[model samples]
Target: MTDYPVSNAAQAASSAYRLASLDQEFLLGDSTRGVRFQLEYQKAQEALRAYGVVSMLVVFGSARVRENGAGRQAFWYAEARAFGRIASLEGGALGGPPYANVVATGGGPGTMEAANRGAHEAGAPTIGFNITLPREQEPNPYTTPALTFRFHYFAMRKMHFAMHAKALVVFPGGFGTFDELFELLTLSQTGKTPRIPIVLVDQDYWRKVIDWRALRENGMVSADDLGLVEFADDGADAWAILKRAGIDAAPTVNNFPLGGT
Candidate 1:
């Protein structure tokens, strides 16, 4: 006896559409799905490729930082803004001779925007990798035309953020900020990335979340892991850390396309 083959739906999810639902499901045929995905992927690839030579400083922080506030909360925003400005000024006017010619940040509001604004104030090009969110993630107006990007995939975006990140400055924030910080630390810890300087601004605020002594006492992390990050009380110190990392100033002045290096 001869056996017949199963239908396409049984073989693949792409062919999940019912025969009667075909006309209502897609204006383009299922065959176009792979092509469409490839095209979108290429756009993302090109966007990542456009950022040439600029050393990235992924600024992670809260989006809810008040347009106005005081104390630690306010200080976090102020300091991040300052970090952006200093990086740009030193990297641009002072010449990033040994460093890449730009500064970059998450392309959203709060600390990210502050960092971008700081770079813009210093008259240096800056980048903003904005995430697509249902609310509160519009790309700030400060991002330079050639450097701004929007990403649907956070992992892809995070990869790009860490790709050339000469340093990382984490300001006080919520889950998202912490998530970014941990990822960088994990990468460095796992040897997936180099031991770049990781700065956490507002030591007091950060302390509330992590009990360093307990971490060590419990043997949850290695002594080397503890050394992976430094805490800063202000922007001046944060900028100083980056400067010490050979990103202080550079000789060149051209966009190197985002992931080229």
Candidate 2:
């Protein structure tokens, strides 16, 4: 029998077919970043489409607010849960496949947990677009496993959030929340995306945190821009606003494309 050289075995091991997962040099290289982004978008889009997520009610809030925390934290959590429940039940999320107006969140603790928990309680499927943060963001237990997703890029994640959004309910939050809120607002303002109901929960909190009047006064934003956001004191109020905006708990055909297509 002829003895094969050791180099042959090494070369065969490095072949494309054998080195797929081990090809970190190509996978993680800068040249493949766009491919990575596309993969992330496609993966999430396919999963959501399989579940028939026609549209979403995007919920933005702080990950730090707790159910038992002091001041309005508990209230915010409870209200968020209630909103999720109401939206899920009314928005046709629990009815059947091709769920519409399902509650979607950042998939973290605090308000994200509350909203997801609410939808779970309503027996509705929910989506959690979790990100890999240095602080280690974990998907909230309440997120529907079939619809839950993890992403490395914030832009792609945000794209998913706004892609099929039918409405936005923003609770008091920190930088992360603000980032999401402003992104939607900018999209709405510029007509970059379709118009959707935008409700800011807790008028008092929002007024204090964001100087809407000041923004208009400074000529930084137009008066019509201020009209883009509505205030809701609680869950009921938020739901009412959404309803008036034509987002009923009833199921409707989703005209929006999946995965921000």
Candidate 3:
């Protein structure tokens, strides 16, 4: 009688092949990076769509600004929180499905936490787009778990940020905040995106940090570019700017299309 070789478990497993969802090796490979980017975008898009989040009020600020910390840190936190609450209350976030002007943040501590916490206080669903970093940025506890997302790619995350945004309220922050603010400014300047309400809280801080006059004088940025950002000293002021930009403070329904269409 001839002896036949029997297939082992490992061999059988290999022969069966791994499902796409379970195939980490292939998914993480260099060749599949584009697919990963698409996956990241699609996942967040689908989740937000399911929640009927059609428009967003994005808040960008320092992750380092603490609630009880010194030198305007606490003030920034309080203002951001207030803005989140006010926007959610007026933007149809608390009304029902097809939530509009929902508060969104970077999903880390400091200002991000403050904004999300405010929305939570108003009893509205909020979004947190947390990114992976070497320093390990953690999502704030106040963010709605179902709407919170972890992103491996910053570009994809930024795309999501701009996609649904109807307004942007920027508070005092550092390099990361500056990066996001400038990118949106560029988009608005170039007419790459629709003109959305962009407000910088604390005129004193912004004027000192960014010399709009100098930029216009030096011809680095046009006068029109400088007009793109409005200054607001407080939450109510910021909301007023948004209201003037055609965002109803109290809308019966969110008729704005997704992606600001």
Candidate 4:
């Protein structure tokens, strides 16, 4: 028998010849979109589990908020920071393993940073679920290094938000804040999610921003739909509302609605 070549050089150099797990080109291809989505969930879920985050107290607010400004700007920032600290201490984050109601934010500046900074000051671990934006959102320094995560897909990011959330506290924000708020409300109304206590900080701002009553009056939404939200005077009031709604008193339930499709 004639001796064969030790190996095919062309085959050895081919992308197809590489291991699937090691092939970035293959992993990032359009064909792997589902894989990417799954990986996004898995990576963050695994990291969170490793860090002992049992349930999340998600804070939503304006990225435009500032530490020191005129009137409500200053007020919102101070309250958000206070809420982060209060929830971290009262919600079982500092108690030890298998933490619950841990302070979590979008992992950017303004409200997110203020909240994270509070938890950091409280000596509690905080979470930052950051996303890639055209403007490039970066993680605030206050989130625990081990607990910080970045996501490529908003779907996956929102899934993470809904999956582990025990409660949601919304501060005054624009479009992005509204998007997160209504999605959770819709989910609550549809029973797609278990009861989520949605508290909007600064009652005056929220009422003017969203004419929710108009929706009910015009027969767009049910009269009961208006009851889905609770208003807070500030961060302390938010926490009290969450407690009465049984956010901490109730057992944490992770319901992946619609099978997380």
Worst 10 residues of 4 by lDDT: 249-258
Query: Per-residue lDDT for 55 in model 2?
Result: 82
Model 4, 1-261: lDDT tens per residue? 446667577877999999999999999999999999999989988898787777889999989989997778999999999999988878878866677888889999999999999888888889999999999998999999999999999888888888888889999999998888888888889988887788999999998988988898899999778888899999999999988887672335465565445
Worst 10 residues of 3 by lDDT: 249-258
* Ordered list by TM-score, greatest first: 2, 4, 3, 1
Tell me each candidate's TM-score.
0.77, 0.93, 0.91, 0.92
Error of 3 at 15 (Å): 9.2
Steric clash pairs (candidate 3): none
lDDT value, residue 166 of candidate 4: 86
Cα miss at 93, model 4 (Å)? 1.0
Residue 171's lDDT within candidate 2 is 96
Report the candidate with higher lDDT, 1 versus 3: 3
Residues 1-261, model 1: lDDT tens digits:
345575655544554544533544552558666554554446645654464444566778887775567656677777888888887777542343233635667778888878788888887777887777877577898888767877666776777667667678888889998888999899888877776789999888888888987898999998888999898889998888767776655443322134345
lDDT string, candidate 2, 26-138, tens digits: 78879889989989988998898788887899999999999999999999999999999988888778777768899999999999999999999999999899999998998
Q: Which regions of candidate 4 deviate over 4 angstroms?
A: 1-8, 249-253, 257-261
lDDT values, one for every candidate: 0.72, 0.89, 0.87, 0.87
**Clashing pairs counted in every model:** 16, 2, 0, 0
Instruction: Name the runs in model 3 displaced over 4 angstroms.
Output: 1-10, 13-16, 249-261
